[model samples]
Target: MASQAMKITLERIALFQFTPTHCAQARAMLGWSVEELSREAGVSVEAIERFEAKREVLDVTRLTLAYRFEAEGLVFFPGFAPGRGMNVKGSTPNPMARADFAMVE
Candidate 1:
């Protein structure tokens, strides 16, 4: 079985793929037109059109798509490593932590 995060990742990818009703759903949920989403997400309206029609998309755009949905949960896995998990907005911690250093007198 895949890890939970991996499973969620696959599920989101699927939702993004077969039947991108999610985009339409997102439009309805967010009250934005496809053109608006495309602009905010820095993608093309034609690309959004194609995504709605064909469910296929560029790897690079996947992150933007999640942002457009306000689906921060979907952003976690792809943008982050397995153990570290997601980062809350406005909080900047080093992804890789280190033990605090001390000086011996």
Candidate 2:
């Protein structure tokens, strides 16, 4: 008997570019075996093995999956806060705004 073809999604496609280091973190942090990571991520064990054993980078298309991996709170890069570089979300405070306000024609 033949196996049915598997379907791939954009998110799954993005993880292809991930470095083996990233995948190893994901597996270790999530307490998952290679098979478990493959099942949860909808990727194949072969791909996971390639990354883990060979340390080869996955394809570029797989990069997008990094966010998804982060969403799981697995092994998103450390020291990277989503808003680290961006301004705070709340309204900005500036008492000097009114004092510095000047109308120029």
- On lDDT, the leading prediction is 1
Q: Report lDDT (CA) for all predictions.
A: 0.49, 0.44
Tens-digit lDDT string for candidate 2 (30-86):
678877765555556776676567555444313423443544543333333222113
Any runs in candidate 2 off by more than 4 Å, and if so which?
1-18, 55-61, 74-105
Off by over 4 Å in 1: 1-19, 71-105
lDDT of 1: 0.49
Give the alpha carbon lDDT tens digit for every residue of 1-105 in model 1. 568688568546744442355556656555689878766666678777877786666644543554445432222232332122154331112211212111100
| RMSD in order of candidates | 13.6, 20.2
Work out the TM-score per prediction: 0.48, 0.45
Global fold similarity of model 2 (TM-score):
0.45
